[model samples]
Target: MSKYDLIIRNGNIVTAETIIQGDIAIKDGKIAETSAGQSLKAIAKSEINADGLHIFPGLIDTHVHFNEPGRTEWEGLETGSRSLAGGGVTTFIDMPLNSTPPAINKKNLALKKAAAEKNSLVHARFWGGLVPENINDLKDLFEDGVLGFKAFMSPSGITDFNHVDDVTIFKGMNEIARLGSLLAVHAESTVICDQLAQEKIAEGKTSARDFVESRPIISEIEAVRRIISYAEATGCKLHIVHASSRKVVEVINEAKLRGVDVTVETCPHYLSLTIKDLEQKGGVAKCCPPLREENEVEGLWNAVANGEIDVIASDHSPAPPHMKEIQDGDYFKAWGGISGAQSTLNVMLTEGYVKRALPLEKIVQLTATNPAKLFGLFPNKGTISVGSDADLAIVNLNESFELKREDLFYRHQHSPYVGKTFNGKIITTLINGELVFKNGDFKKRAQETV
Candidate 1:
C-alpha cells in the first residue's frame, strides 16, 4: 500500500523566512513530512516532478468584493472564486458591499452564506457590514462566523451601504472590540472628499487627472488619524483597507509604535500602478483612494519592502463594461473598481521582483502569510509547514506573458492591467492535495465547504 497520497519533489520551497530545495509528502490533504534535497522513502500514490519551479503557499486574499446573490450581473461567487483559484489563491474573505442587501445583519449573512454554499470553489469567509443602521447587527454576525466588520468612512459608492460618521465609528469599534473581531475601514473621510469633489465639479473639472487631484493625500491621512484615535480609546483592533498614500503609512506606523492595536493593507494596484498609468487607462483604472503619483508609488513600495504594510490584497472589485464607458472618459461618472484577482501574483512578481528586486520571501509574506494571520486562517492556510493544508502553487519564474482582456476568466473582460507583460506564471495550483489548475486548464473538484 502507498504510504502517502501525494509527493511533490525537486522544487525550491519558498516561505516568509527562507527558501530550500525539498520534497513534500502529503497524506489526507495535510502535509506529512518535508525533507530537504531528498525524496521520501515511503511509497506514494501520485508524484509530481517540480524541477526548476518555485513552490509557495497558496495566497489568502483577505479583502475582495465578490458581488453575488443580488449582484451576480456585476460579479458572482462562482467566477470570483474561480479567478482566485487560477491565481493560486486558496482562501478569500468577501466584503459586505456592492451586493444588494449587503451582509450587515444576521438575515443578510444567512443569505450570503446560502449563495456561497452553491458557488464558492475554495474555502471562504465573510465580513459583516458596519453602518449607522447596522450597529445592532454586528454582534449577531460575529457570532455567526463572520471574520470581521467592514466600514466605509466615506460614501461606499453604493447608495444602500451608507458611509459612517465619527459617532457611529466609535460605537461600531466598541461593539467589535467586545466580540474580539477586527474592524476594517475604507479610510477616506467623506466630508473631505465630498467638499473637494463638489468644488471641482462646480469648476467643470471632471477628467481623470482632476478626480485624482480632488481626493488628495490629506483626506486619507486625516481619516487614519481619526480611526487610530478611536481604536486606541476603545481598545479595538483596527485594519485600514487599501491604504494608498505614503503619509497614511507613516501615521499607521507611528500609531503602532504608540501601542495601538492596528494594522494596514495595500492593494496590488496602488503598489504597481500610478497616477500616470491611471491617466492613460482612464475609467478602467479608476478606484477609490485613487492611484497616487510615481514618487508616492515608490514610497508605498518601500513600505512593503520594509514590512511597514502588513498585507497585500486584490481589492478585486469588478463592474460591467457599461459602467466604465471609455468613450465618455469622465472619471466621476465611471464605476470605481479594478478587476485583477487572477493577475495579482503575476503582476506583483513582475513589478516587485523583476523591476524593484524585492525578495521572493517578502512577496510570499505580503500575499499569503500576513493575510492568513490577520483573518484568523493562519497555520493551516498560509504556510508550507508540517500539519498544514497541502495548498500550494508551482511558479515558473522565467516565463513571460502579456496580459490580455480576452484571455482572462473574470465575468467582465475589462482589466486595468491589459497589455502588461509579466515575468512569472502559475503552472499548477493544488488545493487540499488535489490539482485545481494546471497547463492553462481548470480541473473541477468537489465544492468546498465553509
Candidate 2:
C-alpha cells in the first residue's frame, strides 16, 4: 500500500501569505503535507508531475446564483458546479434569490440542499434571504447552517424574493447580529432606482445608457451608507455585495477605518467590463447596478491594488436567453445579470495579476482566503496547509486562451467576456484529492462534502 493516495510534485504553491516551490501530499482526501523547497519522498498510488505550474488553493466563489429548486432552467446546480470546477472553483456560496421559494427558512434551505446534493459537482453552502417576510425566521435559518443572510436594498427582480425596506433591514440586522451570523447586502437604493427607472420608462429612454443613468452612483453609495449605519448600531458583520462604484468602495473603506464591522466585494464583470462593453454587448452585459465608466473601472482597479477591496466574487447571476432580450436589444426590458462564473479567475489573472502586476497573494486573498474566513470555511477550504481539504488548481501562467461561447458551461451560453483573451489557464483542478477537471475536460464528479 502507498504511504499516500496522491502526490503533486515540483509546483509553486501559493497561499494568502506567500508562494513557495513545494510538493503536496494527499491522504484520505486531505492535504497531508506541503513540503517547501523539497519534494515529498513518500510513496503514493498516483503522482502528478506538476513542475513549472502555479498551484493555487481552489477558488471559493462567495456569490453565485445556481437557481436550483425553482429556477434550474436559469442555471442548475450540476451545470453551474461543472462550470465552477472547470474554472478551478471547489466551493461556492449560493445566494438566496432567483431560486423558486427562495432560501428564507430551514425548509427552503433543505429543499435547495436536496437539489444541490443531487446535481452539485462541488461543495456548496447556502445563504438565507433577509426579506420582509422572513425577518422572524432569521434565527432558525442561521442555526440551519446558512453561512449568512443576503438582502437586496432594492428590488431583487424575482417576484417571490422581494427586497427589504429600512425597517425590515434594521430588524433583520439585529436578529442576524444576535445569532452571530453575517449579513450580505445588494446595496442599491430602492427609492432612487424605482424613481429613476419610472422616469426613464415614461420618457421612452430605455437604452443601455438610460439604464445606467437610472441607477446613479449615489444609489449604491446611499445604500452602503445606510447598511453601514445599521451594521454599526446592531453590531452585525456586514458585507456589501457586488459593488460597482469607486465611491461605494470609498464609503466602505472609511467605515472600516471608523471601526464598522464591514467588508466589500466586487465582481469580475465590474472589474473586466465597462459601460462600453455594456453599450456594445447590450443585454448580455446588462446587470443590476450596471457597469460603470472606464474611469470608474480604473478607480476600482486602484482600490484592489490598495487593499481597499476585501473580496472578488463571481456574483454569477445568469438568466435564460429570452430574459436577456437579446433579440429585442432592449436593455431596460432585459433581465439584469452576467454569466461570468467560469471567467472570474481568468479575468482577474489577466487584468490584475498579469497586466497590473498584482501579487499572487492578493489574488488568493480576494478569491479564496477572505471569502473562506468571512463565511467560516477558512483553514479547511481556502488554504494549502496541512489537514485542509485537498482542493487546488494547477495553473499554467504562460498559456493563454480566448474565451468563446462553446467554452462556457453556463446553461445560457452567453457571457460578456466571450471574446476576451486571458493569460493564465486552469490546466487542472483537484477537489478533495479527486481530479475533477484536467486540461479542459471533466475527470470525475465533484466530491460534494458540505
Candidate 3:
C-alpha cells in the first residue's frame, strides 16, 4: 500500500519567497513533504507529472459579493465558488452586502452560512456588514468567526446596508479594535459622489465617461483620509478595499510609514482596464470610484510592483444582465460591479508578471500570501510549504486564451474581459487534495464546513 495519498512531481512550486522545483506528497488533505529535485520513497494512491507547469498556492480572494440567501439570482455561493475555482482560488470571503438581508448579526450570519453550506464548492469565510444601524453587531459577529467587517463610507447601493457616518465608524472601529478584528472599508465620500452624480444627471449626461467624472479622485481620497484618521483614533486595524486612485495609494503608504496599522488592496480591473474601457464598454465596465486614466493605472501597477499595495482581489460582485443596463447604455442606472472572480489570477499573471516582468513571488504575495495573512488564514491556505493544506493551482504560462462569455462560470456569464486574451491558464485546481477542477471541467464535491 502507498504511504502517501498523492504526489505531484516535476513542477515549479511558487511560494511567497522563492520558487522550487519539487515533488509534493499529500496525505489526508495536507502537504506531508516537499522534496526538491529528489524522489520520495513513499508510494502514493495517485501521482501527477506536472512537468513544464507552475504549481502555485491556491489564491485567497479577500473581497467578493456572492449575494446569497436574499439575492442569489445576482450571484449564488455555488456559481461564485465555481468561478473562483476557475480562477485558481481555493478560498474566498464574501462581503455583507448584495445578499438579501446582509450579514450584520447572528441571524443573518446563520442564514448566509446555511446558504453557503448547501452550495459552496470551496472553503468559504465571511465579512460582517458595518452600517450606521449595526454598530452594536460588531463584537457578536466577530465572535461568530467572521474574518472581518466591511464598511462603506460612500453609498453601498443597497437600502439595507447603508453607508456609515463618522460617528458610527468610530463606534464600530472601537469595538472591532477591542476585539482584535479588522475593518475593511469602501472608502469613497458619499457627499462628494452624491453631489457630483446629481450634478451630472441634472446636466442630462448619463454616459460612461460622465459616470467616471461623477466619482472623482477626490471623493475616494477624501474618504480614505477620514477612515484612516478614524482607524488611528479608534486603534482599529483598517483595510482600504478596491483602492483605485494613485493618490489613495500614496496616502496609505504615508500612513503606513507613520506606523498606522493599515493595508490596502486593488482589483484586477483597476490594474488591467482603464477609463477608455469604460467609455467603450459602457455599463459593463462601470464601477464605483470609477476606473482612472492610463497614468493612474500605471501608477497603481508600480505600487503593486513596489510592495506598497498589499493585496489584489477581484472584488467580484455580479448582477443580472438587465442590472448592468447593457441595453440602455446608461452608466448611472447600471449596477456598479464587475463579475471578475474568474479573471483575477489570469490578469495578474499576464499584465503583472509576463508584460511588466514582476516576479512570480510577488504575484503570489499579492494574490495569495498577503491576503491570507491579512485575513487570518495564513500558513494554512496561502503557502505551498510542508503541512499546509494541499490546495494548489497548476498553470501553464506558455499557453494563452481569450476570455469569452462561454468561459465564464458566474451566473450572469459576462465580464469586461470577454474579448481580452491572457497569457497564463489555470489547467487544474486542487482543493484539500481533491481534484476539483481540471481542463475546463468542475468536479463538484460536497460543501465544506468551516
Candidate 4:
C-alpha cells in the first residue's frame, strides 16, 4: 500500500510523448503513481477533479529578468516569482544583467541567490554573465550552481553589463566548454544595430518603425552566423535567444545538421506579433531584435511546428510605466522590453494551439521538457512520471477570456497584451504537490495592489 498526499483524478495528462487520461497520486512532494485502471482504490487526503481539463507538466522558463538587488525598482524577485507562478510556470532561470552586481562572480551570485531565497515562491535558477572581466571567475560561478552563462553579442541595455566582442566571446566559450556548461547569446550584431540606430536618431527618424528598420533581420542573421561559428570552433554548447527571423532559423537548422551543438529559441511575441502591432501599439510593443514582418512571424511558427526551434521562453523583461510610456514617442529612449512574463503560455494557446493546431506534445516539449533536459533538470522537474516532483498545471482548454491590466501579477501592470483574448486558461497550478495558484487568484493580487 502506497501513502498518498494528493490525488488528481481523471485528467488528460499531456506529456512529451502523448496525452493520457489517468489519475495521478502524489506523496512526499513527488509523484508516486499514475493509474488508468483500478490499480489504486485508496484516496488521498486532498483531491482535485479534473475530468475535462488538461494536466501538463510544469513549465520551465529559462530566460527572464527579475532585476533583483540593484534594479528591484524595475521588478523585484518577489513580484517576479508571483508572476511566474500565476503564468503556470513552476521553475524559472533568471538572467544576470538586470540585477546590481550582475552575478558575474561568486559574491554577486550569492547576493542574488540570497534575495531569491527570501522572495521566490517557486524553483529559481540563475544564469551567470560572461563578460571580459569575469573569464577567470567562470569556474567559481559554475560551481556556485549557475545553470549556464549568458552573453550579449550586442549592447546589453544595462549600463555596467557591457556586451562581448569576438575575443571576449571566444575566450568565454572556450572556458565554458571546458567546464561543460552552455553559453546563451543575445545575438544581434552591435556594429549593424548601433550604426543604424545612430543614423536613424540623427535623422530624427526615431519612431518604433524606424527602430525596427534600424535593426533589420541582417543584424540578427550576421550575429547568429558569427556566434555559431565560434561555438563550433570552441565546442561550446550554444543557445540563441529571441530569434525573430526566418533566415536565422534556416541558418540555425543548417548549423544543427552540420553538427554544431546549437539550439534556437523564439519568444511568443515573434510567433504572434509583427511590425504592424509595433506600429500600432507604440513603445509597449518594443523589444530588442524587434518583431519581424507577418511572413517572418509565420515562418517562426512554422519552425516551431516543424520541431526546428528547440524552445519557447517568455524573455520576460519588464520596466516601470514611465520607462515604457514616453510622452514624445521617442521610441529609442523607451525601454526595449515587453512585460510578458504572465502572457507567454496564453499567447501560445491562442496562436499556436487554437489557431494553428500545434500538437499538445510539441507545446509541452517547447515549454517544459526541452528546457528541463537542456539545463540538466530533466526527469526531476520536467516530467509527470514516478519519482518526479509533482509540479503540474491544470488548464481548461475550452474557456476563452480577454486579458486586462488587472489580471497581471507584475509590479507594474502595463503589458501590451492587455487587450488580447486567449484560450486555454490555467485552472490550477501545483508545485511539489502543494496547491500554489488557481484561476481568478491573480485578480485578487491585482486588486490588493490597488
Candidate 5:
C-alpha cells in the first residue's frame, strides 16, 4: 500500500512566513506533512519532481465576472474557471452581476451554483447581489454560504443588477454587519457619473479618452469617502472593489486609523497599465473605475508595497468580440472590461516584484493570503501549512513569456496585455492533491464545489 497519496519533492516552498527547501506530502486531498531537507522514507502513490521551481499557495482571485446563466457567450463558468486555473488560481469568488438573473435571491443563487458545479474547474464561492429587492434575501444567501455581498453605487453595466442608493446602502450595510459578512462596493456615485457623462456628451466628446476623462479620479475618491463614512456609521465591514485612485487609498487608510472596519482591493490592470494604454488599445483597455494616469499607477504601487491595499484581484470581466469590437476600435461604444485572468500572476510578478522590487512575501500576502483571510476562506484556501487543502502553484520566476491574446484560455481571444512580456510563469497547479495543470496542459477536469 502507498504510504501517501502524493509527494511533491525537491521544490523551493515559499509561503507567507518563509521559503524552505522541502517535500510536501498529500493524502486524501489534504496536506499531510512537509519535510525539509530529508528524503521521505514512506512510499507514495505518486510523486512530482518539482526541481528548480518555487512552490507557493495557489492564488485566490476574489473578484471575477463569470457571466453565467444568462451571459455565457461573454464568459461562462467553465471558460472563466479554466482561465483562473491556467493562471494558477485554485479558487475565486464570483461577483453577482452581468449574468441574466444575477445572484440576488435564493433562486438566482441556486441557478448560479448549478451552472458552476457543472462547468467550473476550480472551487467557486458566490457573492450575493445587494439590490433593493434583495434586502430580504441577504440572510438566506449568507446562510447558503455566499462569501459576501457586492453592490454598485452607480448603475451596474447590466440593467438587471440595479444600483443601490444611500438608503439601500445603509440598510444593507447594517444587515451585513449583523450577519458578520463583508459588503463589497463598486464605489462610483451614479449622480456624479451621470452629470459628468452628460456634460461630456453635450460637449461632443465621445471617445475612449473622453469616457475616461468624464469618469475622473475624483469620482472614485468621493464615492470611497462616502462608503467609508457609511461603514464607520453603521459599523459594517466594508471592502472597496477595484479602487483605482490615490485619493481613494488615502481615504481608506484614514478610515482605518479612525477604527473603521474597511479593506480595499485593486486589480492587476490598475497597477500595471495606465490610462495611456487606453489610447492604443481602445475599448479592450477600458474598465469600470477606468485605469488612471502613470502617477496614479505609481501611487497605487506605493500603497501596495506600504501595506495600504489589502488585496490584489483580477477583476476578470470578459466580453465577446461584438461587445469589445476591436475591429472598429471605438472606445465609447465598446464594453468596459479587460480579460487577463490567465495572466494575473505573471503580470503582477513582472510589475510588482521585478520592476518595483516588492518582496515575494508581500506578493503572496496580497494575491493569496489576504484575499482568503478577508473573504473568510482562510486556513483552508490560502496557506501551505499541514492539514490545509493541498492547493499550490509551482512558479518558474526566471521564465519569460510574451502574452498573446491567442494564447489565453478564455473563450474570448482578446486581452489588453497582449504582446506584453512577463518575467514569471506558473509551471504547475495543484488542487486538493490533484495536479490540475502541468506543463501547459490540464491533467484532469476541474472540480467545482458549492
Candidate 6:
C-alpha cells in the first residue's frame, strides 16, 4: 500500500512565517506530512523532484477581472485561469462588474459561478456587486456563497454595472454588516475625476499624462475617507482595492489605528511600472487611478516594506487589442486596465525580493497569506501546512526572462510588462494535488472544490 499519494522533495518551502528546506507529502488532496531535509521514505503514487527550486504556497490573487459569460472575448474564465495557472496562482476572486450581468443578483451570481465551475482551471470565488437598484438582492447572493461585495465609488465603465453613490454604498455597507459579509470598494471620486477628465479633453490635453493627471490623489483620498467613515458607521469589514500611493496607505493605516476593520491592496503595476513606463508603453499602461510619479511608486514600496499594505493582486482587467489601441489612439478613450494576472509573482520576485531585499516571508504574506485571510480561505488555500490543500508553485529563483507576447497565457497576449525581464520563473503549479500547470503546459481540467 502507498503511504502517500504524492511527494515533493529537496525544495525551499516558503510559508507566511519563513522559508525552510524541506519535503512535503500529499494524500487525498491535502498535505499529509512534511520532512525537514529529505524526501519521505514511504511509498507514493507520484513524486516531483523539486531540487534547486523554491516552493511557495500557490498565490491567491484576490482581485482580477476574468470577464466571463458575456465578455469572454475580452477575457474568459478558461484563458483567464490558464493565465493564472501559468503564473502559479491557484485561486482568484473575480470582480463583479466585467462579467455579464455583473453577479449582482442570485441569478447572475449563479451564472458566473456555473461558468467558473465549468471553465476555470483554478479555484474561484466571486464579488457580488453593490449598486443603487440591487440593495435588495444582497441576501440572496450572500446565501449563494459570495465571499464579499464590490462597489465602485466612481463610474464603472460598464454601463450595466452602475457605480454606487454615498446613500447606496452606506446602505449596502449596513446590510453587509448585518449579514456579516465584507465590502470592497474601488475608491475614486466620480465627480472630481469626471470634471477633470472633461476639462482636459475640452482643452485637447488628451495625452497619457493628461489622463494620468485627470485622476488626482485627492480624488482617491476623498473617496477612501468617505468609505472609511461609512464602514466605521456600519461596522462592515472593508477592503480598499488597487491602492496606488503612499498617502492612500497612510489614510488606510490611520483608519486601522482608529479600530476600523479595513485593509489595502496594491497591484503589481503600481509597484513595478510607473509614469515613466506608462509614458513609454503608451495606452497599454493606462489604468484607473493612473500610474504615479517615481517618488509615489517608491512610497508605495515603502508601505509594502513597512507592512502597511495588506494584499497584492493583479487587477488583471484586459481588453481586446482593438479597444486598447497604442500610441496613435486617444489615451482618454482607450481601455483603462492592465492584463497582469501572469506576471504578479515575477514582479514581486524582481521588485521585492531581488531588488529591494524585502523578505520572502513578507512577499508571501502580501501575495498569499494575507489575501487568503482577508477572503476567508487561509488555512485551506493560502499556506503550505499539514492538513491544508496541497497547492504549490515551484519556481527557479535564479532564472530571468524577457516577457514576450508568446510567453503570455492571456487571451489578449498583451501587457505593460511585455519585453520587461523579471526573475522567479514558475516551473510548475499544483492545485489541490492536481498538476495543473508545468513548464507552460496545462493538464486542462476544471478545479472543483468540495
Per candidate, the number of residue pairs that clash is: 0, 0, 1, 0, 0, 0
Report the lDDT of model 1 for residue 147: 94
CA lDDT of every candidate: 0.89, 0.90, 0.90, 0.89, 0.87, 0.91
Q: After superposing candidate 4, which stretches have Cα over 4 Å from the reference?
A: 37-39, 442-450
Give lDDT tens digits, candidate 4, residues 354-393: 9999988888999999999999999998888999989898
lDDT of 4 at 252: 95
Off by over 4 Å in 2: 326-329, 446-449
- How far does residue 140 in candidate 5 sit from its true spot (Å)? 0.9
TM-score of 3: 0.98
Candidate 5 lDDT over 1-450, as tens digits, reads 998999999898877777888899999889999988876677799898888888989999999999998999998998888888889999988898889899999889999999988988888888999998889899999999898999999987888998998999999999999999989999997777889888887777777777888888889888999988899889999999999976798989898999999999999999888878988877788898888899999999989888999999999999987787644434566788989888888878899889989878888899999888888778987888898899899999989988876678898888999999999889889889888888678866546468
What TM-score does each of the candidates earn?
0.98, 0.98, 0.98, 0.97, 0.97, 0.98
- The worst-scoring run of ten residues by lDDT in candidate 6 lies at 441-450
Q: What is the lDDT of residue 260 in candidate 2?
A: 92
> Per-residue lDDT of 170-278 in model 2, one digit per residue for the tens?
9999999999998999999888998999999898888888889999999999999988999899999999999897889999999999999899999988888888898
**Model 5 lDDT, residue 46, Cα:** 89
Which of 1 and 5 is ahead in lDDT?
A: 1
Instruction: After superposing candidate 5 on the true structure, give the runs of residues whose Cα lies further than 4 Å from its correct spot.
Output: 326-330, 446-448
Say which prediction, candidate 2 or candidate 5, comes out ahead on lDDT.
Answer: 2
